[model samples]
Structure formats: structure tokens, C-alpha cells
Target: MVSITSTASLANALRKTIVDTQNQMSKAQVEVSTGRVADLGLALGGGTAQDVSLGVRSADLSSITNSNAVIAARLSTTDTSLETIATTAQNFLETLVGAQSGAGSDAQAIQDNAVSGLKSLIGALDTSIGGVYLFGGVSTSTSPIADYFSDPPSASKDALDQAFVSAFGVTQSDDAVGSITQSQMQSYLEGGFSDLFSASGWTTSWSSASDRATSNRISLSQIADTSVSANDSAFRGIAAAYAMVADSGVTKLGSDAYNEVLRTATTTLSSAIGDLTRLRASVGVMQTNVSNANDSLTAQQNALASQIGALENVDPYEASTRLNNLTTQLETSYTLTGKIQQLTLTKYI
Candidate 1:
């Protein structure tokens, strides 16, 4: 009981076979040229889920890497600003020591240098980069310190002026100012002068910058604090030293009162230098954390990329060989279809 197949049915079946082989050849050629699978789902089949997961993970890691890069840049700027401040404090100390040692007898000249140094230190504390204040803590949009030389005079200057007037009841030029004792001057520094550097004084005199420091997510689980604020002890110490020298007035430079002020300033400046050095070391640790996180992310990204490549990437040589085989199969199918079509029922009878 052999069932005879219809010629039209056989022809239709051959045509479908030819179409399927042509599609395979086309896909192989594309893979050969692009070196990547045209369809991840089709190429990876059941393993597509793993490929998708890797893709998402890679994207997350890349974003973290970029964020860390920005943090690194900000930390670098902060480090530079702190270094500048430290250097300024060191130089001011040298100037103060030189004056106290009486190496140069021109009191007026020493006063001028002190004034200049104070202005420079203020400028450094107020440093900004890319429209963001490095020492402003979380208040990146505003300068952290006011210019001491502004036309109207900053609140810090006005406060010092009042303190001087109250202390001696006369200006620095009065001979009575020369009679002020060292202990009295020290009292002013530890009391009023020190007050000017206090948090309350800063709020009144300095710009209203935040006391909260900036931080960054350097890793998946870690957030690193990356900035030192202008409210830090080192900054306060330097500012107090400079303010004492600058606000004490020119007439008082050669007096016993001025020498006592200089001595206090030198001690404060020396302490500030040590504080800044320690702060810089802390910033260095932050820098290292960021760098290490960057490296770790990069390594993870590379590993994920390799996994995706294994699932989606095509071997060019293998694709080329497969394409040639499909091409031969397609040509043979066409030849056989032609031969079968020629064998009509009439020609066979």
C-alpha cells in the first residue's frame, strides 16, 4: 500500500527547503562580516538570560567608575588648595620669625609684609574651581571667606577694630597704645582674637558656607568623605594669625604691643602648619581609595565584557566557513529543484 506523492507537493517542499537554506547562508554572511551574532536570543538560546544580566551589571559598574572619576578630580582640587594654604602659613611664619629676630629693623616694612601675607591666606581659603568652592564644605556655590581688603571692610576687620578701640580706648598711633602690656595683648588674642576664629564668629563675619563636608560613593558599599572644610582648625589658626597682624595698624608695628601680637601669631601659624600637613595626609588616603575603586571597577567591567563576548561574539573564520557550506547546499538544492521540475508527467510517460 504505497501512497504516491503529488508533484506539486514535492515542488512546494523543495522550495521551502531552498528558502530555509538561503536564510541560513544570509545569517552566516552577516556574522562573518560583523563578527557578532545578529540576535543574542537566537544565538545564545537558553543562555540569553546570563548575557542580559551581565549587560546590566556592566552598565552599573561603568556609571560608578564615571562618578568616582569626578570625585577624584574634586579631591585633587581640594588637595591643591590645602597645599597652597599650608605654604602660605609657612611663609608667614618665616616672615614673623625674621621680624622678631630683628634681622631687618624697618618695622613699617615688616607690617606691610604681614598685611600682604594675610590677604594671600584669605584668598587661598576662598579658592574656587569650576564654579565650586573647594573649601566651602557642602556650600560649593559660594566663596567661603570674604576679602579682608574689600572697600567697606569685612565683618572680621570691623570686629577687630572695635576690639582694639575697646582695649586701649585709643588708636594705635596714641603713645598710650605703646604702654599696653604683653599680658593684656595676650588676653586680647586668647579672648577676642580667638573669638573671631570661633564658629560663631565665622558665621557672623565669613560667608555663610556649609559646615558639612562633601562625600562620594567610591564603591558599591562604601562612601568616602572627600573634602576638608574652611571651618577646620588649621584654617582658623591661620586666619587668626593674619588678622592680628593686619588689623593691629601701622603705628603699632614697632611697639611692645605689636611684638606680643607677632609672637602669638607665630605660635598659631606654626600649629596651623602641622594641622594642614595632617589634613593633607588624610586627603591622600581618600585619593588612594578613589584610585583603587576605579581600578576595581575597571577590572569587573572587563570581566563582564569578556563574558558577553563569549555569548554574543562570532568567530569570523568559523562564520566564513559555515557561510561557504550553506552556499554549496543552497546551490545543490536549486539544481535538484530544477531537475525535478523538468520531470513532468507527460515527459516521464
Candidate 2:
């Protein structure tokens, strides 16, 4: 052995190298946990811009997920409101059918039931979800139907028209006059109202509005408003006939009068039921669409979570293996450095 005094110096240098290796190992552990190679530019010496861009993209996806959650809640609320309207409309039709067929002594009672049913139906149309009217035209500020007499007599065409116009908006033009049925008019009105708030484009959702594209504006708030002027006109005619039959001058309603009332009621009720059925079908489609959208969103979110994890999360097994290899290399380097220092000519001499 040379017995070199430089052994201490070599040992000191080797110890320093070991300390530096240990520090690097510690830093690697931090990188694995955080899913980021700290000081990528300094350590890896490249890709600074790409790292920054990926960070921004991850943040944006997180924001989109939050927005979708809000939209789903509002859509659920609207769907519930639609179900209520459908049920109420169905009940009203049944009650009207019974009233028309009942005895003469129960005329007032039957009329009262009809008025109550009308009120309930009107109430259903005018109800709102999240402050957005279910039936009112673009304006959620007012009721869709008002000014109807509940007792003794039927309401006027003008009153019905006004209500329809309020509920449907400018879509119920002057030309859509006397030719329309109440059922058609109601459908037109409801459809127009609903159309104003229909879903326009592809987006997760918005509460007040949603735009999947820049140019598309689907209104999810408005109900469809079809022409119900004929139904309205028919009801007016029935009320007039009923008034004649009730008057002292008319001992009884002739077969013609009875057939006309029954015909008008049946026709109006059938049309109304058709309109409601179509609406129900539309709601079913919308519910399915919403459910599909929710499922898709959930799947996307899960996929995104996995992607984020792949990008950022560290595998403990792999990290531990790498750490062990680096430790072994550092130990071997120190051992070799010691052996190099011990080799000398002194012991041979």
C-alpha cells in the first residue's frame, strides 16, 4: 500500500458524492409524489412550453366538469314540471267527459268541476322551474291563462285569445284567427313557448341558456304553442248553446244541440289529448337525451381522471425500483473510489 495521506482527501470527496446522490434521490421521491419533475427545464434541459401548456389544459377540463354538473340539475327540474303538466291535463280531460254526460240537476256541479279542472290546467301551464316559466312565452313574468269565468258560463274567445297570445307570444298572428281550434291554438302556443327555450347546440348545459355552438340558440325554456283557436271557437259555441238550453224560452236542448255539444267536447278533448301526448313523447325523448348526456359526461370525466393520473401520478413500485438502482450505483461508486485510494507501492516495498 502506498500509505498516501491523500486517502483522507479521497474519502472526503467520495463522501461528498454520496451525499449529493442521496439528495438527488430525495428530490426524485418528491417528483414521483407530485407527478411533476421539478425544474424540468433545469433538470431535463427541455420542453418548458409544453409542460406549461398541459397544465393549462388540465385546469380547463376541470372547469368544464363543474359547469356540466350545474346544467344537469336544472334540466332535471324542468323535466319534473313537464310530468306534472301532463298528469294534470289528463285528469282535466276525464273530468270534462264525466261532466258532459252527467244529469241535469248536476249541471252547476259539473260546470264547477270543469272550471276547477281548467284552473288546475292553467296553473300547470303557468308554473315555473328555476324562475323560468314552463308555458309562458319568452316572458316568464306573467301567467299564461287568466280572465276565465269558473261558474255558470264559459269564457269569451277574446279572453282565450289574449291568454293564448300571452302564453305563445307573436307566433299567434292575426291570420291564425277563427279557423283555429282551442286545442290547435293551445298546441301552437305551448310549442312556441317551449321552442324559445329548446336546447340549441351541443354543450354540457347552462341553467338560463346553453350554446353548444356560437351560432345556435336552442331554447330549453319554452313549451310548444300550437293553434287552439278552433277549440276556443268551439267552446264559445257550446257555451252559447248551453245558455240557450238553460234559458226559460227553451224547454229542452234538441237532439241537434245535444249532439253538437257532445261532438264539440269530444273533438276538443281528443285534440287536446293528442297535443298532450305529443308533448309527453317529447318529454320522454328529452329525458332520454338528458340521461344519455349524463352518462356520457360521467364516462368522459372518468376517462379524463385516468388521463390526468397517467400524466401526473407516480407508480410507487417503479419509483422504488429506480431509487434502489440509483442507491446501488452510488454505493458502488464510493466503494470503487475507496479501493482506488488504497492501491499504493508502499506495502510492496
Query: Positional deviation of 337 in candidate 2, in angstroms?
Result: 24
Error of 1 at 342 (Å): 15
Clashes of each: 0, 44
Error of 2 at 184 (Å): 22
How much is 166 displaced in model 1, in angstroms?
3.4
User: TM-score for all predictions?
Assistant: 0.81, 0.47
Report the C-alpha lDDT of model 1 over 1-349, residue by residue, as the tens digit. 9999877788889899999998888788789888889777887889999999999989888888988878888888778877777777787788889878986636667667678877777777677777888788888898888887788977777777777778768766676666777788878778866887888787688646677888878777788887878888778788788777766664554367678887888898899888889889989999999999888898888999999888889988889989999889988989888987887879757
Error of 1 at 100 (Å): 1.3
**For model 1, which pairs clash?**
none
